[model samples]
Target chain A: MSLLGGGIFKGMAVTLRNFVGSYFYKDRLTTNDYSWRPSDKLPQHAGEYPKEEGEQLRDTTTVTNYSRNFPMLLHDGSEPMDTIRCVACQICERECPPQCIYIEKSTEKKENAGGKPQFYPAKFDIDVSVCMSCQICVEVCPFDAIVMNSQFELSTPDRFGGLLLRRDDLLKSNDYYHNIHPEEAAARDKRIAEEKAAKEAKKKAAAEAARKKAEEKAKADAEASEGTPDIQEDAE
Target chain B: MSLELIRDILVATVPLLLIFPTLFAFTTWLERKALARIQNRIGPNKVGVPLTRYGGRFSLFGLGQPMADGIKMLFKENIVPRDADRLFHLLAPILALIPAMLVLCFLPIDFPWINNIQDSVKAFMLDGAVIFFFAITGLNTLAVFMAGWASRNKYSLLGGMRAIAQMVSYEIPLVLSAVIVVMMVGSLNAAEIANAQAGWNWFIFTPWGLAAFIIFFIAALAETNRSPFDLPEAESEIIAGYFTEYSGFKFALFFLGEYIAMFAISGLAVTLFLGGGAGPGVAALPWLSVIWFLVKIFALIAVMIWLRGTLPRLRVDQLMGFAWKFLLPLSILNIFIAGSALHLLAGGRLAGLDEKQPILRQLMEGANPLVVAGLWIGALLILYVAANGLNQLSRAKVRPREYKYAE
Candidate 1:
């Protein structure tokens, strides 16, 4: 009798929940995508798009299209491609375990030809197929050349043709990068500004030292011409 | 074919087919939600958006999670372990799923989706559905074995062995319990059994009917490999049991099969005990019968989920002991009682034997009150002792101590 009571009550509790849930969450109760409801209001950032002036955004907010980090959310919330953080560093390419990454560094005809922006990556490619998403490249990148993008919906029928990403696809502006990762971007910007200020100060000190040396040389030449430096030379 | 009948069959079957997959999906969601609730967390909330523009911004919590999962599996690199039985590994998940899907064929959803199919020789009409349902469910064990053997892994092999033993052992009680049901109704057809339980005479409400329902429910739980009977797939022990080596769409197929089997068992339980699709005062309104059937299935499914959340997995030896020593004997006794009661009912031996009989008829009835009371009291005492013993035994078996590798 106890066994019967426990089992019956336990079973009844479960059924009661389902019976109640069926009414409140009816859309979820069925297998079909009945949760879809179209709306007329455009996306919040619709005004930002210059090309779509006065045009309404299509409401595709179906249950099927919802995702936590949806691609649409990424587009609307952040500009992820703004920062030119890559400094033609080959570290990301070297550390990529899959060898999916390729980089062509900019080269000059002459070595040590006055600091004229010595290096730039001329070509870059990341074969997403072979890339295992291990984040090794991102972790090892010294100049932060690569980072994992949250846009995961990269489905395409022609796998071979559509998956490989070129430099153009990878390239993003500093503003976009700041928008997506604001905290990291702010910290990086402060660090870079400090380094630039230090470099300018060092350059100013060197120029001042050079000017002092030239002035001493001119004074010595004038003293020789005038025979006035002979007393100090004899004393030394 | 008469157009009305054809339409009826189509409508009936389409919902049934749709319900199967829908329940499968919902079960996945329900499991996640329940597990999350137990762990004090939210699960799968990022799947979809709110239907209305002004409604509190909604997301299905990754409700399209299963879709994404399916797509990922489809596109994933399918790797077969080098040491595995390649042919069997490739064939196992499909083998497991096909029989599960096939079981849905005999299920009657509502009235004939097409009433005309009754006359069509080529229509999907299962004459002896009870036997067919049992035969197919039995075949599911073979698929489990194939999965274990194909993997070439020790954990999987052990899991397979446990599953086969557990299922084979429980099959007796399960069949015997249903045998009593069939004996009482004098029919092996599921629909007939359901029809027999019409009105308030639902089998669960009767003395023998209640016993059979309890026995059937326990046996069904064991048969489905659900917890405390879920030793076969005990995660801590077997690492996903027989499917350790499977991945991608193959893994999904195994998952789909398990849920579908769960669905079938729930449907079976409802049909056998809780009056299948029969509703109170619902015979007059035929359309409401389908709704009643769905309600029962969902209720049963919810119970399975709750059990999963509440119970711990039973150890292999303990599980076998419980099945053989307790459930088996109880089920056999239940059958005997049912058989005797049914025989008496058929022969009208118990008719007019009650205290309500007239004075002149009472002497002719010749009912023995002491014997009846003794039998009832004896049965009650046995049940009480068994319940207390089980409780004490479970409590005495303290949880295993956790081993730490380092400080």
Candidate 2:
């Protein structure tokens, strides 16, 4: 028979070794102090926490490419509102399971990133408190306008007002999107580019077919006139 | 009381207030740091003597964390439930603190502050100091129950009932184990017990004391609601157990009471088994005993913290069964074995030795050295064999768990 309580003593020895090893071996520690991290690697929201000079960064803990919390509106250019891709189709708002997404389509059309005049969302608000982070909004978005953000540090003291994200807060740069989820943003950008290329090819193919059809009709009409003239001459 | 007696009382009591609370604060910091290191994470290094925020000039490894915690606790709102019994709710924490603090008087630690050693010894000495210590410590359970019952929350009530059940079950084994030492000492006085194990003649050197000490330590862990025996304060299941409703300074008071109780209990264990303040070089400098005593107490506390990190909480049934089935019976058997061993040792030159004298002293007084050696070996063999037999008997039905996932 095995010694009783031997497992406990063994476990104690392991923990003791770990406790001592952690002090000497830096690699033993899984997480280091984030404040010691360089300012560039600091997150965008780090300014809210206590940081040194030029350390206006967010808490970058637990943030990774695969991590997703809530939906954010993506804009291509520096100007978030002007270059916004959302046409206010209300697809995500309608498809939202919790009905947490609120959108108001602008009456007047505005020039989007594609230089096409489109109805932008006049008011976009998402109640993050109600959001289950199912990414359904991301899935249903047609214009590639909405995507999941990796910033999970969304705890707020104000339930209604604080958690309810406004249009400005929802608007994030494509570069910021790339930084948060590089592979996803890259794949999405490639897909949108491929769709634009396919649409151009389809339009060119249709224009070539229309021109060829017009030429054939003209040729047939000319041939018919010549045949009628030849019959008249034969009658004379 | 006369002026000299009042001075003497203040002299005896004031240092306990000063030393233990300070030690309590330091122990909190130490526990966090040690546990963090054990788990391979840096703990509480943020709050320190920060000369400049983000400067990293002189971060003193979060030494200021305990001070900061105290300040935060002081500033927090003392929230009380609306439907709660307000009077008992208020009194529960106070009651917890009193028994914990009161039992500190019974440990036979001799501080150097007292110029006259006789008066100081008198303060710690009582005819039934060990029994009185146990009686007062039992009141800690009442405070726990009071807090649990007063809150009127279902979790709190559940926690209180658990505290009652666990404490009651463990107290038997706890007392029975200590009974070995008291039987060996032939007196219930705390001072006599400490003095009995003078020098390296610690009761733990004996086979029965070893068994009893181990049993006592386990029971003490349960008694203090420490981890592995921390079913009452099962954080995930019952929230924070009885103290779920308590917050602010009242919660802090509970925390303080728990640590002080830890110190008090560890102190008792040292007195009973480890030879109270009986380290080497005590003869050269008398003040070293106080330091040695504190060191031994800290050692036990350190092990408690380590075990907390190492062991998972025992299931409620296992906790009760282990106490009743294993520790209780073994401790009961341990007392008998210890008594018979003492009788066996009291032969040859020790035959005429005074009965009131400690068994160790009587043995040391020119008993056959070979007989003493044989007795040690024989007693150890007997206890070990009996313990193994009991283990096999108790665990007869507890079949080894069969895993389906992998071989």
Candidate 3:
């Protein structure tokens, strides 16, 4: 009889604990809709969210200033978000399994008088409905223009039109991108600036050398036209 | 003819009937979620949208998934093996499924009779419900054999043999445990047994009652071919076992039957050990009894899911050894103890005890605490030793022998 009582009590205790505990944690764990809220802070990368107070301080102040080559932590500070290393290459569009990504190359316009076209992506769109979230687009993107976001709560009505995000919807400012993926963005910006500076320096050195060579040639021509062939006779 | 009475019956049954299927659907979701958690991953979060009528935006993927799975099974091309017995092949799934659903008819989810029922006819009868439940469950083995033999496949044959072996081994313990309850209550009716256990006197609170409950639970697990004992359809050893040759909706019928069987057996456990629909002051408010009953059933199902997630499947011979050697003997002992207690109570040797006092009260009054604790500890130790011994013995028997070269 005692055996039976103990067993029943033990079982009851387990369930009672669970029920009571759930009630106590209701405020933190409840999935009710009224609790959800949006914020202005940039979403943290996949695994790089701050943990300790010290880590949070480092993440907010120091980590955000690091260059693009540095790994960006995502959601739990466990997954690395390697962004900004994109070369603007269109390989991701071609390899997308769901064909959700659309990219339009910037083309120079002959009709309009203009400087050399730097970048032109007129209409970039991604249909989130069609996207399988396989991360294939992220994998194949040469310029790393597209990335997998940890923002999973994308519920909407009307499957066809509501889920299709245009360029405006997907676009983030450079500062916002850096804040989310600090280390990677900083590294990329530094690399781009270094490459541009190196190209300019090379061009300037070549032009200076050419100018000196032309001046020397002009002096020789003028001296030849002057008819100064008696230099050796005067020395004798 | 009264509208209120009709509404009451409809309200009662609609919930009872819906409870099974709704739990079945949720069980599918829960199983996936639990398995994913065990394996360190997320599962089915993308299905049906959250906080919406149609479900959240991403929820369509999750919601449509089950529908898509069903349609795929429905449209799949059915293939019949050339050498298979066609008649039995067609009949087996139906046979398996029908009994699974039929047993629910005897299951009393609410009051025995609604207020509007003519006094001549009882809306529900709990009398002989135990025997009826056992009889239907007994037929499951036959369906399993039919499926195995009809397929004409070696794996199917092996699976069928295992099922028969398991069912035979567990059936003795299952029935013996129930006999303990019957002897105490002096009635075969589930509702009567429940009524006998009013207030805090649920059968699970006594010496024999505890033993019987454990024995019954373990036996039921084996009977349902659930995890640890689910050697028949061991995916690693025999892919899908008896139903390997079955395809399309025919195969789905078997799947559905298994889950329904699981629900039925869990319901039976609730009826036997947990006092069925008898809760505090529940006789007056019978409706609350059903709710209490369902809460217990769902809790049991959750435990089943947890067990499935946590444990690996047991080997075939290990399963048989556990049932025949351990559960059978323990359950038999439990019956004897219950019989002795009943005899003592009936003879009036124990004072201040009503013969009709629930099992819980009898245990609280009559049993020696020290002896009870010793017996329980001893039983647990014995079970542990027996399991390890059998595991070793099986290993030794199956060990590969090295061949000696002739001199």
Candidate 4:
């Protein structure tokens, strides 16, 4: 009858409701399952795999994508030709707020498209303990060489060795990136495709111009020869 | 000291010793898991393995957590304060457990209904077991005082004082509520009191009995220092209360004592109001009595856990006031109502249609259900009006505050 104890009962009723609802209702259960296994029917589009019938699914693609704090090196191309995207540009190193990244250009030279030699990083080390995970390195990388990684289980017992991630340790496959951040990975792939198309178009235009110049030169040479023969006949 | 006597004593007490501690541990696990559910989280399911991980699968939960905790406690260094009274400090936790164990012995569990086995195998039979149970439980207050005083800490001292005040105040209502049942049965023996409510005559069916049960239950909560009434050991208020100076195994002992006491009191409530183990088929299948008794206790304990999960701790003054001002009067009035109702209806037949009669006869002539129900309804109406009046009286004393706006 009194309002004094009514609030307690209301609170108790709320707890009871939660206790029951937790068992029967999926939405009511607030535990964030940290299991890494993705469900088979997870809103996966036609990527490289086919779906089976009536798979237990989760709409993970629609849900919030995991934020990548630590930066990692992207390994470009497949197997034998695979090269580190980083060309020792030093942009990410300079822009890094915490100055955790270290880069050393290689003494040996590798041929570029123009036949000039270019240097790649011989030593790349990230003292991850000092990294603030602010994503400045990822943003500053002009070559699209560095990107933030979503793998957050970086706990290490070793202070010096474990925390200091080397170039090999930081290298991740493009497939790995696509799996974690599909939207970003797709956007990057589209941009790369556009760039390749533009480069091919430029090469074709240059070849056509070269052919026209060569033809004109050939005609001029014939004309000069004809003029030389005429002068000889006149002199005779 | 004879071999037969020794065997008889062992038969009575061996199960109590083995079962209660294990139940207490399981209760702790259950409470944690249930509370986590109420809060919408997965509780402790990562601690222990049920079996070997075969074929990359295992059905493991934190079942071994209590055992692990016991082992950890055993290996821990028991720390005592530099300025503490070493002797009392050492003895305090042990003292706390003693009364709790003693109280368990007084409970009359699994006494068969049909079999005229007057002296069935039981732990201990005291004529005034209800009184003895309360008295032994009361000694836990002294243990709290010892722990508080010996610790030489301010928080411990405050907790000890609060424990004394809370336990003493709540014990009155708790005992008074039980007194109504004792009055109805006209015997101090727990077995007689239980037998009096045989078949469908469970005291909980009556209005006065229900009111007494509620009062007794709430008081019991305070008495056991459960949440909402657990001001003495309130973490935000006092460190660890009376057990502030205790560490390791000593702290474990205090914990064991508190949980065991919670269960024992709940068991007492079942015995007094819920007709002990007198359920259908319990007489024929005597072993079923244990199951029924345990089920009732577990239900009551679940309610306790629910209360813990739901309500926040009461403030010191509110705790004391509720015990004295509210519960005491309610229980006293409940006793009076039950007494009068018993006298007017059924012509003061203290036996409740003769306990010796068969179940069918007891059901047919047991205290005229209509007249008993009518009396209870009348009493409930009176209680309702009284509660409403008191509510108004309390509200009238408070002055309303006025607010002014600044221009």
Top candidate on DockQ is: 2
Better of 1 and 4 by TM-score: 4
Cα misplacement distance, residue A232 of candidate 1 (Å): 38
Candidate 2 per-residue lDDT, tens place, A1-236, comes to: 66777788999999999999997887887564655444555443422233565644342432355667788899999888899999999999899999999999999999988888999999999999999999999988889999988666666779899999999999998998888788788999999999989988887777666556655655565576655322111110
Model 4's DockQ?
0.49
TM-score of predicted chain A against the true chain A, for each candidate: 0.54, 0.76, 0.47, 0.67
Q: What's the TM-score of every candidate structure?
A: 0.57, 0.81, 0.59, 0.80
Model 3 regions lying over 4 Å from their true place: A1-236, B1-19, B29-84, B112-128, B152-154, B339-407
Per-residue C-alpha lDDT of model 1 across residues B156-256, encoded as one tens digit per residue: 99989999999998888888878776765656667667776666557676555676677788888888888778877888899988888888889888888
Q: What share of the true interface contacts does each candidate keep?
A: 0.00, 0.90, 0.00, 0.85
Using lDDT as the yardstick, the better of models 3 and 4 is 4
lDDT per residue (tens digit) for residues B33-125 in model 3: 655544444456554744456454446426544544566889998888999999998888888877877676556566544545543233236
Per-residue lDDT for A236 in model 4? Answer: 8
Model 3 has an lDDT value of: 0.66
TM-score of 2: 0.81
Range of the 10 consecutive residues with the lowest summed lDDT in candidate 1 chain B: B355-364
Error of 1 at B195 (Å): 0.7
Q: List candidate 1 segments past 4 Å from native.
A: A1-236, B1-15, B49-57, B119-127, B343-407
lDDT: worst 10-residue window of model 1 chain A: A67-76
Q: Which ten residues in a row have the lowest lDDT in candidate 2 chain B?
A: B50-59
How high is the CA lDDT of each candidate model?
0.66, 0.85, 0.66, 0.77
